[model samples]
Target: MTALGLVHPGHGAEDDYPRIEQLLGSDIRVDLVHTDLGEEPRRAEALRAAGLAERLTAGVEELRLAGAEAVVWASAGGSFSHGWEGAQQQVRDLARAAGMPASSTSFGFVHAVREVGARRVAVGTAYPPRVAELFADFLRAGGVEVVAVRDGGDPPADGVAGWGEERVLALARDADRPEAEAVLLPDTALHTVSCLPELEKELGKPVLTAAQVTVWEALRLVDRRVHAPRLGTLFTREPVVQV
Candidate 1:
């Protein structure tokens, strides 16, 4: 059984760990650590000042004590808020500090898209429209095209986690477009891990949600892939044909 360590930037969102466990089974242990991000609004400046590298290092040390093989920063907005280069550097710093493979959800979205072989994608988020646009910019900086993007804007401070599955999937459906090979919902706040199949069915494409890809990327960092049908196309076993 492989143990994975996750460092979340704020309180709450512990629901994600169990969701990952349900798909991958109880054998794969997930060690969770939360970092206090204060009560400040989750804007770019505030998020950059959150000092996740230091906090994440502590979490990594804790997970190492628990026998974790890899660690992941499970915040989508927090990492992307650092922009492309900064996000890369943040991950590098985390790996260096943790002495193990580390990743952030922002980069997880990119890696998931690349794994699915998509160059163009639609983004659906539970963030301010401007923040969602930042994600578009982030993807563009990574060489992936954003065909459509939409968001509810800043959701009254405490509103994102309370969003129901129907609401999240609606936002995803709205962002779905003809040119997009995948629809990306980039928020660790919303409870998305349970509705991946519903979202993928609604969008008629590979649907990548924040928590889903974060766990996937962490597994990928260690060269592991779990093929589960309920986890959507990304986790389905790739069929091999005779050459």
Candidate 2:
């Protein structure tokens, strides 16, 4: 059985993994290592920026020790805090440290966009406009067009993490642009897996969110392919799919 390692941000999203595992079917084992980035609402941004690489590497090492075949940084904004090149280097460094391939949720978004054959894309976020703009720039650097964006202000990062499914789904549906081929909701903190089928059906286009794509990318790295029909285009795409 293939083992995939996940380095998650905090305590809340642990319940989401079993569903991801079930969606992936029986060929893989997921080993998760939790790292608390602290809960100080006032220091969220500064903490996210400063602690990303350190947290990522620490989690990677732990997973490696636990016999994980691959490591995935399960936080979207975390690796992305360092910007585009920094994001790439972060993964490279993690991979080197872990003696295995490494990836992040931000990289997963990049991969998912290409997996679904999307070029022009629109993004929506529960982050501030400034934080969301960082994602926009990252996508631009990866050669994808960011047609439009909607930020739900800088809701306290913890509050944003605790956002309910209905509000999260509504924000995604409303932020989708008709002109764009795909919609990207780039927040790992938000719960998105349960709403993907509904979102894709309504949008009539691929909907790529952080958690879903991160799992997809992690599975691919370990040579596992999951055909979870309800999870939309990202999960349904073959492992050989480009990007």
Candidate 3:
């Protein structure tokens, strides 16, 4: 069995695995470890800037205890908050603590974009403009050009969690840029797995979200091959091997 670890911000959007499992047709196990984002009206800056290494390590340790082979920090704003280098170090440290390879949703976007051979890309997020820009910078640091970005302002965390598929698809469609080869929706709080296939068809390009990329990266880390037609380019594309 392939066990993947997830550290979610809250109860929001934690159900992404079942959809992926449904698409991949069983045989994959998901182990989710949740952490509270504290209270509502939370500031992305504060969460990003806080010293979360201990908390993250604790969460990964729990996953390791549960037999997780790989761990993914499932929050975009949390990792993007520390900037690119900071986010990289956060994952590195978590892996050291857990004695397993680790990654985050923010980095997963970069990997998924590269996996699909996308250069110029558009970003859609349910965060404030400031938070969204941080994500753009994170992608830029990884050598992916951000051609466009759309923000959903500061909706209540729960409200974002409950965002309907129509609204998510509309935001993704609006954020799609002519110059972009793919559109990236970078929030695990948003339910995106269900909309990826239709969104890809509507936009005529690859559409990837946090939850989907998170699963893809975790599977790659464990050296497992997973292909699902409905998950779009990230799934359909072959994994590249680096010597």
lDDT of 1 by residue, 1-243 (tens): 888888887765568668777889767877788887765535656666664577667667788888878988988877888889988899999889888998898888988888777789998776777777878999999888898888766655665778888888788888899999999988777788788889888878899988788888888888887877788787884532322
- What TM-scores do the predictions have? 0.92, 0.90, 0.93
What candidate 2 gets wrong by more than 4 Å, as runs, is: 39-51, 156-158, 239-243
Instruction: For candidate 3, write residues 168-202 as lDDT tens digits.
Output: 98889889989999999887778888878898999
Q: Rank the candidates by TM-score, best first.
A: 3, 1, 2
Score candidate 3 by TM-score against the native.
Answer: 0.93
Better of 1 and 3 by lDDT: 3
Tell me the whole-model lDDT of each prediction, alpha carbons only: 0.80, 0.77, 0.82
- Per-residue alpha-carbon lDDT of candidate 2 for residues 1-243, written as tens digits (9 for 90 to 100): 778898887765566677777777787767888776665422337536534666667767678877888888887777676677888888898888789989888888887888888888988887677778877888888888999998877566456657786787788777888889999988776777777888888788989987788788887788777778877888786543553
**Clashes per prediction?**
2, 0, 0
- Model 3 clashing residue pairs (backbone): none
CA error at residue 184 for candidate 3, angstroms: 0.6
- Cα lDDT for residue 41, model 1? 39
